[model samples]
Target: MQTFTLNDGNKIPAIGFGTFQIPSDGSTYKAVSAALKLGYRHIDTAVAYFNEGEVGQAVRDSGIPRDEIWVTSKLWLQDYGEEPAKKAIDLSLKKLGLDYVDLYLIHQPYGDVPGAWRAMEAAKQAGKIKSIGVSNMTPKIWQQFVPQFDTLPSVNQVEFNPYFQQTALRQILAKNDVKLEAWAPLGQGNQDLFKEPILNGLAEKYNKNVGQIILRFENQEGIIVFPKSVHEARIKSNLDIFDFELTADEVAQIRTLDTGKGMHDPDAPGVGDMLLSGVRFDNVAQKDSQKSNR
Candidate 1:
């Protein structure tokens, strides 16, 4: 697996197994176990995913050395305050059955981001996390948010794909030396993307599927991509992107598909409220909160 060096000097695998919508009913564990067996060293999960424990269990059972794998989780908006964020970190660690995560991110741009980031910075200093970053932040939000902190974010994971390429955001992130991680890199499996002439042409030229061609395009752009799937064949094929390379012109051809806009707006009305209302602190975190109230 190819690795990208973060601004913080930590190396992260370019391709990972994303566990966002994977159900926790033992399916997450089975899928994760299969991913590990298939040679995926990086795993991305979040507190909001409600499957961190299952992911942890899979990792423990994989028999892979703990350090050989990279585990990433996020701090939800409900745990945005410094103290709550600290407790949330501990809770995530306890559930993961690990001392520290490879990466911890501010899951969204809302809430007390500074306070949460301060907690993350302290965690990095204390060796509780190897790196820290944010997700779904727009270029405007990033410009304002980054200046308020002493520590730079190692990455900005956003919704990026061939159609919505985020050119302005990439330029800013590049200028700040922050790596861009693509969350919905396959456009949420949109079939229209599969029919694109540019991507189709490239897929034919490379003798790979449209999905692989798209992933390879992002990989060549130095963007970290983690396409999620519970199916074993798709999971296995997702990692088989390192064998080929696209020439500069061919890469530019892929770039022509950019629409300069993403499907979801992070700043849309009710987005923050909707996300906040869905907060579900695990039993461990809830107990910690109750104790603190005593």
Candidate 2:
């Protein structure tokens, strides 16, 4: 697996397995175990996902040394204060059955983020987390946060795919030595993405799935992608990008698909307000509130 050098000099796998909507009925455990067996060393999960314990069990049962795998989790909005964030970190560590996590992120750019960053930075110094970052933050939020701290973010995980390219944000992050991690690299199964002519053409030329073509393109562009799939075939195929390389022309062809937007922008006007207002989970109450407010 190819690795990217973080701003702090740590190496992170360019590709990872994401467990966002993985079923909680033991399927998450099985999927994670299978993924590890299939040679995946990076795993992305979040406190909001409510499956950290299962993922931790799978990792422990796999008998793989904790150091060999890169485990990442996030601090939910409800736990954004300094004391609360510290407690949340302890809870996350306990859930993952580890003393430290490879990476810990501020799940969203909302809540008391400055307080959260203070706790996260403390965790880093105390060796409770190897690296610290923020997820779903825009360039503006990043610029605002970067200057307030001594430690820079090592990574910024966001919703990125062919359609939502994150061009300007990528440039700003690159300037600050932060790597971009894509959360929905396959666009959460958007039919239009699978139908793009350029992607389809590349799929045929490489004898790969459209998903594989899309992931390959993003990987070549230096974006760390965590494509989620419970199916073994799809997981295997997603990790098979190292075998073939896309040409410069092919990369350029796919670049035209960029819409210069994010499909899941946490920093959008109303969305930012909701996040900052302390909507912790994607439960019925939160869903209803978001709908009514919109």
Best by TM-score: 1
> Each prediction's Cα lDDT score?
0.89, 0.86
Candidate 2, residue 116: how far the Cα is off, in Å: 0.7
Native-to-model Cα distance after best TM-score fit, residue 156 in candidate 2, in Å: 0.5
Candidates' RMSD to native: 3.4, 5.5
63-128 per-residue lDDT for model 2 (tens digits): 899889999999898888899899889878877777899999998887588899999999999999
Worst 10 residues of 1 by lDDT: 285-294
Error of 1 at 58 (Å): 1.0
lDDT for 203 (candidate 2): 93
Model 2 off-target regions past 4 Å?
277-294
